[model samples]
Target: MDRQFEAGPRVAAVICAAGAGSRAGRAEPKQFREIGGEAMLTSAVRLFLDHPRVGHLNVVIGAGQRARYDAAVAGFSDPRLGAPSIGGATRQASVRAGLAALDAEAPDIVLVHDAARPFASTGLIDRAIEAALRDGGAVPAAPVTDTICVAAADGSRGETFDRAALRALQTPQAFRYADLVAAHARAEAEGRDDFTDDGALYAWAGGRVALFEGEARNIKLTTQDQFDDDLLRRAGRAFLAQGDVRTGSGFDVHAFGPGDHVMLGGVRVPHAFGLMGHSDADVALHALTDAVLGALGDGDIGAHFPPSDAAWKGADSAQFLADACRRVREAGGAVAHLDLTVIGESPKVGPHREAIRARIAEIAGVAIGRVGVKATTTESLGFAGRREGLAALASATIRLPFRDEDGL
Candidate 1:
């Protein structure tokens, strides 16, 4: 160790998942595909995000992968998670890209792991960080169990190699930040991109390499069968048992107030009068927010953004819906779908249905297809029929964890 290790060294986690994973034989890319009822990349990212030693996480992904990546990481809120960086053609290039993403605030240590391997435990993470501090560069490796043999070009055994000297490497490889960065730079300059892992790059750069114990069960998912196994194990967890299918409904009405436009599903539409309330009074979003709260057994919008608070005056209703979505995610659940109906005589919704759906999807962090919006009048029977006020009815379907006592 050339430099004295910091007593509290800041460690960053880098997840390399840029590969297309064609070998997995799945319709979607392996990382984005579900393993434990969640995206494989999401599970992998969460493991480190939950680790106390990791101060930051930078996930490297391929081009055009941002949308799905955002969906995978939507629920977690942590300052340690950085924006996704675009990766290059190869694994080494992708890792370099991730490292470059952290150049502005390089931590004392970095743990680079593959996204395909979702089972790296917290204990392993601690070991890697400790090993990096003590050994300069260290990788987790499992001892070889099978007999080893050197093969000839034509598939003939040339000679038997010693099994005692063999070990299979795994990720969560830890390295001193500056040393790893410099080694990668050297590899790039030398046009030596053949190294498969960072440890090899470190060794090629004439840096000392150390090995730490690795898990045999921390296997990477390379095929669909492995993915199925992952999901099976995930199902075995008590928290993942099926039961909670909650549906919540919300209704909101705002009388015609003097304004030039009104907000609906985060989109603004010209109207003779705007909805009046503590916030922008986006009736559709307010209804949807309440519906989400109802599904969560949480209180309505007023309880969250009380009208008594002056800060909420003239606030954008999208914030309320976003807050509701965040709550749902934090509770280890998701809003499966949203259906909204607009009850009004003016400011027709037909012209802006697609726009409104897209806006709601954006605010709720859900797919546009999952959002349904419709418009209908009260047939000239009540206040809505007389065009005195506008009302919205919304329903939210959410999936929540089933507790032992709350079984169906």
Candidate 2:
């Protein structure tokens, strides 16, 4: 008899273990501290290794803790797990280093998690990966159920804040590999180091960050009291070990008809004639929009924002693309990954790729790492060779909740 089988998505796990954990008052980093008969790092690594969607793993450890983390994780080894790399002084720096250590070949997605969050559930990781693959940047987060406060430094009460609008962020934040690399490069070049987490970095780099409801049990073990095996087990109770993955493709074209400027992927390219259309007619944005819409099973750009409607006349194509992404989210589907290619002859895509990716991420409501925008030429073969027009292609993946849950 034949057997039935199901496959999960492929994702690379990047575990950040470089924090000193001074607040925990431990000689060893909190990630390396013993928890439930094993080092915290061991438990954390095991979570990803055992996860069905996890295809590759890389650990970023403090320079001195490399050997310790290696030894701790040795017994749980698998081909998916890569060797540990020495990390930098800051969390962002450590992430950059960890990303650099990724195998030369790319994976479908990359999950950047903190080893300190030992209680992170496999379900949460799967959900995050699903969201990242669908929405561009998916992060595990819990809504703030309690009343919030804006307090003074001395602990004196100040203004009470609205909890409804607040969310407590957590991790195993996942991104598409190309988007993450580009965001890191932009941040590093801009000399920014203030990001508290990878998601923040993505947001700072103009990438959209979508929030997924996180399990209360999936807490980061920042202090001794936060480390409880029973709590972790309880948190994993509602978690399912399964995951899903899908891919979609997008294509767009704009002819050089008449205008002073050409818009490609939301960036203005100086030219004699612009792509003529109802909107700004950016081929890149249209392709990406179609890709995202396709992943969500939502109809294409024309279906959502019709050219027949004058409201979109000469409107920024970037916003139109973004609105399409918003509709996808409202429908309970999340964008996980996106890859885009721009084909043009005159206005070079290489010089504007990063900016274009950033714009697309912003419009699609995803982190920069979840969006990939590249450029190429047809070697002057078709109308593009005569500088007559530009074209673009894009692909996207999305995750939808099993039953249309409200928060996730």
Candidate 3:
């Protein structure tokens, strides 16, 4: 419930995602597509949900999209987000449906946005709200930079005009709650549902519309080329730039015990003996769990799941690593990479290296490429050389929102 803005009028947002976006060149709608390691819808919802001014929000979805929507926002909880509003065939209708859903709460201001455009920044939202409060309506727009042209029926240029007065309008358009409701009502009554955006509808209904600055990077993903590896990398960097990077290291040792298999990185490798620990003696995962916690400065694994607690007796260590990853997410961060080195002599790690890496990646909810597993021997100088125990060293790299020096 912590926010960064001063309190004002109650703000709500309608995220329009009901359209069957065939142009995005995907089987599913573009809003359900993956962007920056998450669904486009999730990114958009998180943007408005995290804003201080927004008190209520609703997502308008097409029929039969409930399952996809649930999976995209799985584990996310916020009182501001209500049930999904059933949308009509058109974007205008979909937005109206969302607006109608919010009629019960009747927020002071409403910002209508496209779920496809997930990169809109908080500053842009601030400008839109400010303009809406000053004027009656606001639209985020960018100046047209390309040469003006007119296309004819035969695909020929008809006219060339000056581009100075041209502007490319974007979404997250802001308007007074009552004014927008009245505008939509008028449009529906007149059987006019052709308005592509709310700003135009409001304007046609005699509402004053003002323009505000828009970010160049606030793009609506609409093509397959936009999902290219290189483009996504740049987009990920832009998204992650708001956070600071951190790295932490951890080490753990577990002696041998009587068992048929040993758990390493959540994988059971057949061995003559297993590692000894309070839980499933997963040395690799325990070290990784500690490394992740260390990066967040949230203490080690023992602090969160104490050994004295009988509840964790014989528990799966994968849950420990999963919990650590959850904490990072709750703190508004993401795991960038994880590296683990197993030091042992008995259970040869080479044969199960790929499995260990895959298991760790699955447990951490990251790509397999982001998880690295390596094995080394102690050269007959330590307990690992004598095959008395197994040891692991791990490092975790994470990205977190920038905190003031004193804030930590």
Top-TM-score structure, candidate number? 3
lDDT of 2: 0.77
Could you tell me every candidate's TM-score relative to the true structure?
A: 0.56, 0.54, 0.58
Put the candidates in TM-score order, highest first.
3, 1, 2
lDDT of 1 by residue, 168-248 (tens): 899999999999999999999999888889999999898888999888867888876666755678666644443477999
Model 3 lDDT per residue over 1-408, tens place: 111233568789999989888887778888998876789999888877656567888999999999999987785788888999989989899999999999998777889999999878766777788788778688999988899889988999989878899888998999988889999999999999999999999999988789999878788888788777788888677656646889999899999989999999998999999788999989999999999999989999999999999989999999999999999989888898999999988799998887687678768876565789999999877888999999999999999877687375
Which residue pairs does candidate 3 place in steric collision?
A: none
Worst 10 residues of 3 by lDDT: 1-10
- The candidate, 1 or 2, that scores higher on TM-score is 1
Please provide, for model 2 over 1-408, each residue's C-alpha lDDT reduced to its tens digit, 9 standing for 90 to 100. Answer: 011123444578899998888877667678887765688888888877765457788998887776787678879748888888888878899999889988574766789988887767655775787678777777887878788777899988889988877788988897877788889999999999767799988877777888887878667778655645576555444232212344667898888887887887777877888897888888888888888777666788999889999998998988867776787668656677778888877787676676576566656656555777777889989987878888888898876545535333
For model 1, give the 10-residue run with minimal summed lDDT.
234-243
Q: What stretches of model 1 exceed 4 Å from their correct place?
A: 156-160, 228-408
Each prediction's whole-model lDDT (CA): 0.87, 0.77, 0.87
Please give the TM-score that candidate 3 achieves against the real structure. 0.58
